[model samples]
Target: MELKAISDDEKQRYKTVVLKFLEDLSYNLDDKAIINYINKLKKEFAPKTARMHIIRIRAFLKFIDHPIANLIELPKVPKRRRRLVIKVEHVRDLLREIDEKLSGPYRLKLKSAVLLSATSGLRAEELYKLRLEDIDLENRTIFVRAEIAKDYEDRVTFFSKEAQDVLEEYLNTFKPSNPLFSKKSLLHQFSKLDTRLRMKHMRKFFSQQSDRLGMPTAVKKILMGHSTAGDVDLSHYDFQDEEELKKIYDEYWKNFRILG
Candidate 1:
């Protein structure tokens, strides 16, 4: 079977998860064994992590054409409490506080990243995976390659002019050819700050900004790279003209902007 469809990282994760699960049993591959394994995982791991393990197992079983693959069922992952989104008025103030505390290249990197995340709604993983070529400063757009995307599908997203300006300055200074932000760099920079003020909160900022600005739900979902799989109508809506999406982005981009 073609297990090479997933990335090396994901494959390694599959290995680790499967091994841990197998160790819990006597290497059984029956539905009862699998369900029992999931029960064990529910106690040991977070609901989301446990759900992911079940998904991986299901995929693997299907790929190998195991008999029980069709019979396995996964439990719903419990909903997590929403994180507090950064308010619109506090946007510039938070950026200013972080910028003032740090200096030189570190300051530029974190500030630029936060601006991009706030404006574009790209996840930290997606932002870190960005390469210099992925950005189009003149057009105010960023192309997220499928491999780096969480959905395993390629899509385009946009940034505000304010974010574009900061990004341009950053590109001019760093002149990056590979990934724009290293995992270590993002982790180190975010670790120093309060949890409420961390890089992850920028996504919440983008969500709230979209609501406050009244961006169309369709446009907002596209910009955020959210999958419209179950929404029968939205899947078709997603296929409409890219230029129209860009127009909406351009029209509403400034509504999320931070003060200089």
Candidate 2:
């Protein structure tokens, strides 16, 4: 794929992993050296992380026509259980903790982000790249633009009445035009690494909430910006009306409200 085809976030991650590997290892790209590098990665990273880095390395080696690329076997990554962090009370506690830790502008920013993510099921990057025009407070909808989406497919997501109230206040106060979450401004007071991890979990919370509400698997995937194109009938023949989607969204999402 062309450089422009992938999002900057993904590219940056790949670059970081590759650079770290290069920095640690000598120039020898033989089977033994590669295996040693994999061992070192396995020691430092989780199995998933190690596997991802190995995949990237394998791709790069293939692109370069390296001989050892054929000899490299991918690490066997065991299936891991997903951590369910979508309990409304747990999310409320986290939001409260964030409020206690952060002050002034950034606190509100983070609160809005957490709330929005829980309600809308947007990926972190999608939330970051959200434009002012993408939000429709009147309609209670957020348009995840094609350009910012991980799959490069455009879709719509909705926020709850509670989330709409908070989001409206945030938009009025900050008046952000382009990027909704500006690291220089909104994240100025916070550790970027910590905030990034929190945002990731928040996205997972959205997915879990969707499941808890008994949303159809296809609808849940659509709401989460995950590709539903895997099913030919659902992708091409089935037409989901916006009103039907909104009804489904509202039905199960009301239970997601953060309780005191």
- Top candidate when judged by lDDT against the true structure: 1
Q: List the candidate 2 regions with Cα displacement exceeding 4 Å.
A: 1-53, 183-197, 230-238, 254-256
Residue 130 lDDT (model 2) = 80
Instruction: Tell me model 1's lDDT, rounded to 2 decimals.
Output: 0.79
Clashing pairs in 1: none
Local lDDT at 209 for model 2: 73
Q: What lDDT score belongs to each candidate, Candidate 1 first?
A: 0.79, 0.74
Candidate 1 lDDT trough over 10 residues, lowest sum: 1-10
Local lDDT at 186 for model 1: 74
Task: Give me the displacement of residue 232 in model 2, in angstroms.
Answer: 7.5
Supply candidate 1's per-residue lDDT for 184: 74
Candidate 1's displacement at residue 238, Å, is: 2.0
- lDDT (tens digit, per residue) of candidate 2 on 1-260: 45557657788887777777666666666767777888887898888878899888887778779888887777778887866455777778777777778876577777888788878888877887787788888888888888888888888888877777777787788775677775455445446323334666777877877787787767767778766556964564236877777778888884457744
Writing each residue's lDDT as its tens digit, candidate 1 over 1-260 gives: 24455557777898887777667767777778877776787788787877798888777778779887787777678687976757866677767876777777777788888898899889888888888788888888889999888888988988988888887888889775578877678778767655457666788788888888888777788778888979766676698676778888878885446975
- TM-score each candidate: 0.70, 0.78
RMSD list, candidates in order: 4.5, 3.9
